[model samples]
Target: MARARRTATRWWRWRRSPLRRRIDVAEAWVLLGAWLLAVAGGLLAGLLTTGTVERDLDRQRSERRESPAVVTTDAVAAADQAPVKQIGARSVWATVRWSTPDGSAHTGRTRVPPGTRAGTTITVWTDQRGRLVDEPLSGADAWLRAAIAGVLVAAGAGGAVWVGGRLVRVRLDRQRLRQWGEEWDRIGTQWGRKTG
Candidate 1:
């Protein structure tokens, strides 16, 4: 019963009462609208961002291809070059030459296993234009990226709505306070007892 009374008290602005001022009603409406917008807007933003990211990943997977390339230079151990290991293997940068389907050749630098000798065949990813490119994300990776993007976009959208609502509520509160001060001044002057 106590909890029910507290809930009712909390919603007093919505109840019809002589004490319920216009500002109270306005504040209640603002709170409700902010909650609704935050939920709906967050959901919409999340879905759109997720879909866009997934589609882009899918397009990349479709557009990129792998080609065999020959190592033009021996690869140096990554530990010798950098203090921190970048990946699983001690990979090092080396120049590689590859031929496109159109018989055109291209040379690019890519990471290769440490101590990789020249003339070693290695698979490299490329775009439609035959330029060397990073391999497209795997299925699991794409899903993870999309999920993260969706969550971040959703949180941002919700936060923006919350901030906007908070600003409006603060302005309303200030206005109410100013009006109350003016009313009190008038009433106090009539009583011949002015109080700051």
Candidate 2:
């Protein structure tokens, strides 16, 4: 029991020393601030990203259900028939307006070449449900955009955490070293004269 009390008293004295106390408090604050900032920024980014994804999904669904038919077969429309746009060397899109079998007219854009005109008849493909699908994009621009955004967010958050930890560690190390030096000096003065 006496030994335990001595150990406790020594520990209390070391901790109550001014340098050690400041070091401990600074370390605690750094860790707390780092975690809090990360969590707050992560939540904000997640909410905005989720909303954007939902909106895009809704738009795609609507397009799939109501868009015009894309050309998939050989078509022979008049030279002045359809509004065509060149997407690539071999790909084109034509805006078409036609009446369905039930006498209801709908207009949509179709992917085709520059061969049809404004008033000519052209043969184009229609699915069983008769909805147009836009031509798919060829590159990875969409994925690249998302990846860049993720990297930016990660870099910002990681930098904050690193800086906070470094500051805390440096401050604590200085305080601990100073206190240790003082303790050694006191011990030497007390024992050196007695042993002499």
Candidate 3:
């Protein structure tokens, strides 16, 4: 039993050498960098993309607010009332009847995405030019945007994790190779000798 214990201890000690440790450390750093970079890139990309979308939406909103138009909201009663029809993905084209500031109503066609659904209350703005626009987002709309953003963030996190794992694996392999080299050197002089 004592001899067996000694053998096990010897084996364990041989497995962990300085070269192996160095390789392990180096590999760790590589993976750490990969993970950090992936995370940073993902965050930056998400921020830029989402920000761009928000800015465009905001610009359109402001334009609608500034125009000499009227804003009105009503529930879409049926298919006839559907100002925009869901045709292609996020593409809707329809004509809608909306009110004006002078207590007058006009019917005009508007093109929007398919996100607007039947039975949803939509706000419409019409200018003196007879150009009609709709408020695409409401309180629930903001929440939905946030949810989409959250999904993008999650995807970024996943990318980071994947990169980190790859880096860790690379480091482990380097460590093993370094350890093997050092072990070989140590055993070279005493090759075929039973002592080592």
Candidate 3, which ten residues in sequence have the lowest lDDT sum? Answer: 66-75
Off by more than 4 A, model 2:
1-22, 42-144
State the displacement of the C-alpha of residue 14, model 2, in Å, after optimal TM-score superposition.
16
Q: How many backbone clashes does candidate 2 have?
A: 11
**What digit string (tens of lDDT, one per residue) describes model 1 on residues 21-81?**
8998999999999999999999999999999999999999999999999999877643456
TM values, all candidates: 0.88, 0.37, 0.44
Q: What is the lDDT for 53 in model 3?
A: 63
TM-score result, candidate 1: 0.88
* Residue pairs with backbone atoms closer than 3 Å in model 3 (clashes): 27-171, 31-167, 90-114
Tens-digit per-residue lDDT, 1-196, candidate 3 = 3554443443332365654465555665666666776667667766766666666666655556322322122223333366654444344444455556666767655543344453344455644554675654654575568557855875776586776778678767876978788888998967867863
- Find the 10 residues in a row with the least total lDDT in model 1: 1-10
Best by lDDT: 1
Q: How many steric clashes between backbone atoms does each model show?
A: 0, 11, 3
Query: Native-vs-model 1 lDDT?
Result: 0.91
Cα shift from native, residue 161, model 1 (Å): 0.8
